[model samples]
Target: MNNKAFEVLQKEAPEVSEVWQQFLLKASALDEKTQNLVYLSVLSAFHLENRIPFHVKMAKMHGATRDEVISAVLVGLPALGNIVTTALSVAIEAFDKD
Candidate 1:
């Protein structure tokens, strides 16, 4: 079942998806309990194209502070540049569900 899932993903995005899959697997070295920050950071970076609410919920479930999540979004500013960061900020606000 999982192999089928992976095959589908690889077929859909061979190069980028493979890199992401490997990166995620490598992240396991940090331990699940302590990886919330890392996950939240990536979640923020992927916010424009990914499921923001889902990741936000996961971050909350992992005991992440709202500030921590916002900081994650802010951290993307340098790498993503101002415009992309602004787009991500909008996603963050939407995810806040407030």
Candidate 2:
């Protein structure tokens, strides 16, 4: 929520941000938990550490268990290798948070 780039985009190009939000809303065909799981996997694969916590929390809110969050992070290991480990701790910490 404190992402500066996103904040700047919303401030400077509100229309573009609105469109992106619309796209996300329309494009999310999967159930909320599944979508969050897919998103967590992508974030892990890409090593997007900064974004992981938010999505992990979202995933948990959508009924993802801590073990499911861990599995989601590790799901990319076969394809991408140990690089995904960088996100494992962050995701777990976020999911464990109350």
C-alpha lDDT values of all predictions: 0.61, 0.88
Candidate 1 has a TM-score of 0.51
lDDT of 1 by residue, 40-75 (tens): 566556554344555566666767667776776677
Error of 1 at 56 (Å): 0.9
Model 2, span 35-75: residue lDDT tens: 88888899889878899888888888889999999999999
Backbone clash count, each prediction separately:
0, 0
Model 1, residue 84: distance off in Å is 4.0
The lowest-lDDT stretch of 10 consecutive residues in candidate 2 is 1-10
Q: Residue 91 in candidate 2 has what lDDT?
A: 92
Query: What RMSD does model 1 have?
Result: 7.0
